[model samples]
Target chain A: MTSRRQLLKSAVLGGGAGVVAATALGSLGPEAAFGAAAPDVEPGAPDPDFAEGRIRSIKDNTLLVLGSNMVFHNIRVVDGTSLWKLGPTTFDQAKPGDGLYARGVRMPDGVLAAESVWLNIVNIKGHVSNITSEKIHLDHKGQEVLCHRVAGKSIAVYSDAPPSADLSLLRVGQHVQILGAWRPDTNEVDIATVFSPH
Target chain B: MARSQPTDPPIDLQAAVRGEVSWFCCGTAWGPCSSTGKGACGTCNSGNLQHAWPNTSDACWAITRPDSCGFALSRRTCGFQHRITALCSGTSVVTSIADCGPQTDLFCGERSCCGATCATDRIIDLTPAAYSRIASLSTGLRPCEISTP
Candidate 1:
């Protein structure tokens, strides 16, 4: 089977490189790829490396974010920093109250020199209340959410197993988690992935 | 249970603790996020049974700084299994630590209440696959219990 990892590689690095990588690491399971051990850092310290949270304030190009843990982050967006919302976007589009996840080189002064910032990305836990070739209907916390599947983009993983491009594994009343781009101010989302334990 | 796999173990309920959970995505469908590709763990996909925890490594812990908020999370490495249960519906899903996230320190005192149930402290962030398994992506945050299986 064409594992989701291979499909992701192909999507990001092109088919040739993806195939090469797939062959090079064929014996390993997907989890094995993330199992490498790394050195430890100080306890209770700000990553000085990455940041995620709500935008508390924005002044000039700097964003003061309050993280979910109550930690504050000063994220500085440079020309090289990439921003995304429903799709690729610019920093000017960011607003207070927007949620963001940033990855960057932490400056000695403690500001996150953001390399990339994603806005309003959400992962929801819901049940596959309904499904069709084009969309999946979900009941999340008693609210209805419409998830549209993009061709060649959305995929699924079953019960900690390797991910596949198949959505056939999905069924009504089946619990699932969907990771996707949230369309701001709507009850809808673009499904990027679906996870089910089948 | 429709497409049941007999090989998979049963979901465990004994390992539960209440906290707040949210969701995030990589390999986006449009715009700049689309370039996010995978994640810190190259294998992270929105559709996979994955999640981001406050403490996945020394480096990750330093970043999330859950200690600043008085939550001491153990250093769990990538691919560690965690089962999150949504308090609103009691629905649950098992996910692996795919990356670091939901900076516990930022929302230290924050609480999410659903009916009579309320949870505080952002302890975990789920991939869409994991998050959608128990709650709505639109709700953004939910009260949940996390336990090992």
Candidate 2:
């Protein structure tokens, strides 16, 4: 019998899905696991298959979370789980008080069998207040948010164009929306994708 | 529980307004959103196709002056409908005003773009249900164009 540790190692090494399927854990198919699509429900209704909250504790592979609705949730993380912090990362990087949005299947016992977890991810709509070689200053709701650029990792999408790595088009005072990893306990974020409509 | 929809007041046809759009949770409390309360309308919910307009009231206008961003916004009461389109996806969702929000003046002159189409300032705040219909919840913000339905 393959141990859970071995299964995790294989899953991480083998690149995410085939091993989980072969091991009889549900298939994390392309459409379901990677699309990051939310369930079809009324606009303001809480999604049954989604959970958003802060991590209260971590026991082995299960995460104890206190949701925005004051509900308790147990999220079971596995090898197939795509954990993202500032960028693509591993599960061990998740810690207490880290905010998250998890999408997955809910088991019979109400445990969410997570497929993807985005940790401390925040999308900010702001104007470029200033720019330095290493960081972009964003004026968000009168607050200054220092956004750092990750070399070779940060990307941009300019008005209907495909995402590219060129950051030169970003002009000071341009309104931009940034998808980034929030540096907890601080006002900093590492840019992952920056979208400029113009 | 069954709920009655409020009758909408007559809308004055106007040109589409452009700006940044964001989401805020109301109704049932959750995490850092607990302080948001049930919104100014008292009927706000995260799961409804509702939104917050900066010009809902004089008090609200004091807090969210869109003019500070060089945009003039007309005042509309709760339950008035506005058709909002996401610049990124061109996805549209018609939502009614449920509360006052988005503090436009705070981030005056902010802009967002999708291509040749770009929007400036913070003009509206949508409920999770309304926003998620056009953009993902995790994204928190999007560039948008708003108009009367």
Candidate 3:
């Protein structure tokens, strides 16, 4: 008999872009709206179904993670998993020492069967202290964060408008929220999306 | 209920105050957070619907200093309830003051918007439990509007 996991794997692999779109964009869609139930977790504590840490080792399809609490975790990636680094990506792009957040079901053996993985992602609020031709400097919680613009990959959302490739509206001293991929071990990040109010 | 003290000033505004919203971990242990202890008020928990206000106390005011960014914020102590709405997700949560933080002065003139609704600066920080009620935990920051309930 075909198991649920095997069925999902086949569907995800064969479905291509349509499946990828739903998994990528609707990954965080409101669970309540769909009547989907969330795994119960204690208030204020780290969620058991989610793991946040740096990858220590990658052995084939499994990732050994060293969590922020100094605990260790094993994350298993299947074909159905949606892997996102700077953007929608494949499993091969994953590397050692990269920070990540994995959401999935915890198997009885304690291995996490990851459904989604976001690597080196950092969401930050800051003021644009300065802007050059390619870099935007931000002051985040008194710390200076260097943000590099990836030409084709970078986009901006102004005043709740649709995203555009144009970043000309950004000005010095305007408060903004940046969704970007961290450079790992550095204060720099690669800008993905910049949200600003005009 | 947290009653205003004799020395506490009245907040007389009718419009909702808008600003940037973020989340922090507190109490117990979790992922990269480890433990934030009990926070400034000594009562914060990650699982509770609590938040941090910039102008909680004189020392907190000195650190956050919303005024440095041209915004005047009222001093609300711990346990005071405030309704926070996340502009990005169009969700709202009622949480009480649990600590002090997000140093508004650091990113003084930051602005964010969703459609015609917009907000400026960092004014509130909610616990993991409270923040997740409105926006995804992966989305670390959002534009929001705050009001006294």
Summarize candidate 3's per-residue lDDT along A1-198 as a digit string, tens digits: 533333334434445553454354344333221122335444333456567678999998889988765779998776557677768788899999888777665666788766667788766667899999899999876778899999898888774467799998899998877777888777888988887755
DockQ of each two-chain model:
0.05, 0.14, 0.18
Work out the TM-score per prediction.
0.42, 0.59, 0.65
In candidate 1 chain A, what residue range of length 10 has the lowest lDDT sum?
A: A30-39
TM-score of 2: 0.59
Model 3 lDDT tens row, B1-149:
23332333333254688888877766553322332577788888655678888878888888777777766678778888888888876667778887888778776666666666767777898875566566655455678888976
Candidate 1 vs candidate 2, DockQ winner: 2
By DockQ, rank the candidates, best first.
3, 2, 1
Considering chain A alone, what is the TM-score of candidate 1?
0.56
Better of 1 and 3 by lDDT: 3
**What's the TM for chain B in candidate 3?**
0.86
**Overall lDDT per candidate, in order of appearance:** 0.64, 0.70, 0.70
Candidate 2 stretches greater than 4 Å from native: A1-43, A68-70, B1-149
Of models 1 and 3, which has the larger DockQ?
3
Question: lDDT by residue for model 1 over A49-135, one digit each (tens)?
Answer: 456667888998789988654678998765445566645578899998777776544555677665456677666666678998888
